[model samples]
Target: MNGYDSALFENRTVVVTGAGRGIGAAVVVAFLGCGAKVVAHAGRDLSHTEGDLLSRVPQGARSRLTLLTEDLSQPEGGADLARQILDRTDRVDVLVNNAGTMGGRIAAGTETREDYDHILDLNIRSVVALTGALLPALKAVDGASIVNTVSISGRSGGSAGSALYSGAKAFVSAWTKTLAKELAPDGIRVNAVSPGTIMTDFHRRYSSKEKLDATAAAIPLKRLGTADDCAPAYLFLAANALSGYMTGQILEVNGGQLMP
Candidate 1:
């Protein structure tokens, strides 16, 4: 479980959004374990962090973690969060844009303008604002990396009632590549981790038990994924030692669900 070098990220600064639970929490813990000072955005409040992130992080590592809460669904939410981060640190060595949600299942014809706005605002706009605001901080360091969280649905189009969610993730998948190329000269590597059927609060809210079971049965591993299952991939893509030459790639962590 602890295969990574203990000091892989020593003295580095990593910013992880949506880090209060599930995959984001796992990624934060992994980076801290590797000796990185992590600035974690714990969603809209600290409640989720109390329930998930706080419990998983070790007491010693907690000193290195700076927890913040922000509602990234608002228009200026990402920029506001960036302001808070820049006020604390002058340079960011790694940026993990993991904040986003489906908002909810909206049926095709029943969707409203508000529904589209919520999905796109949180999934797309916030990411853009945050990444844009942090570009200077990232550029201050050498070999800075940005690891985005995408979805398998971006490639498969997802199940019923998830069209908007699927499309938003697809946008991120494409943006990851675009930013990788655009920022290559600045020494910033951009990549994404697309997960599938992770048994997180996300699925508990949107997916049914029967659907999850069926998804597990069809996968080559014959099991659904866990937050821990996907954490290492983010670590790999962020560390220059591991992925210095790798950028603009979407690392799929779906248990062989989608090979494309």
Candidate 2:
């Protein structure tokens, strides 16, 4: 056995999309902590969190970090990003399709065709496209894994202004299971992380503290989840030593906000 075999993702190469901030960024950190080399992809040149936050993670950990910027909403963009990673690494053991967009005016007469198209393109299309583009790399790994970032809004109807967002995520959850089986033969596992209202920038934009408190009151956990809380699920899925047999499953991290 490898010296770091018990360390979960030791020596694995992990790619995290939309890793500029929030849960995506947290997942990147988690994978790095597990001894995996991380390729962080962001939609924009600017980071969602401070760039230095990751750079500060100790020199040894920082050595495993690489940042790539690409707009996944476009078909060419996804392919380009995948190619960039392939060019830099021999194999990718884990692919986290965590990059997505939310929020579209969903009120009656407010939803527009353009808004629907944009949300679907970013949240669903990009996930599908990127996964397809990276299939070869994932297949080459001994125990590769893919984790899609879904949302509880996908399972149930979302707030009044989230029709497109919810529908897009619903598609992600369903697609994740299908891909898991299709890729299993190649030793690649596919899964998803569906989070309920979490205290990320995404949630903060849609809700104020008072609003978040009221929403939390309705949840069983009596509080909103944090990015830190949801990140481990991705780490677990990425770590072959931990979740090698787990595939086609949706691990919800919502502070008990939504339960099966």
TM-scores, all candidates, are 0.98, 0.92
**Tens digits of per-residue lDDT for model 1, 162-217:** 99989999999999999999999999999999998899999999998998999999
Any residue pairs clashing in model 2, and if so which? none
- Over the stretch 126-178, how does candidate 2's per-residue lDDT look in tens digits? 77877888888888778888999998989977777888888889898889888
Best by TM-score: 1
| Model 2 ranges with Cα > 4 A deviation | 1-6, 49-56
lDDT of 2 at 19: 85
Give the C-alpha miss distance for residue 70 in model 1, angstroms: 0.6
- State the local distance difference test value for candidate 1: 0.93
Count steric clashes of candidate 1: 0
Q: Give residue 105's error in model 2 in angstroms.
A: 3.4
Angstrom error at residue 137, model 2: 0.8
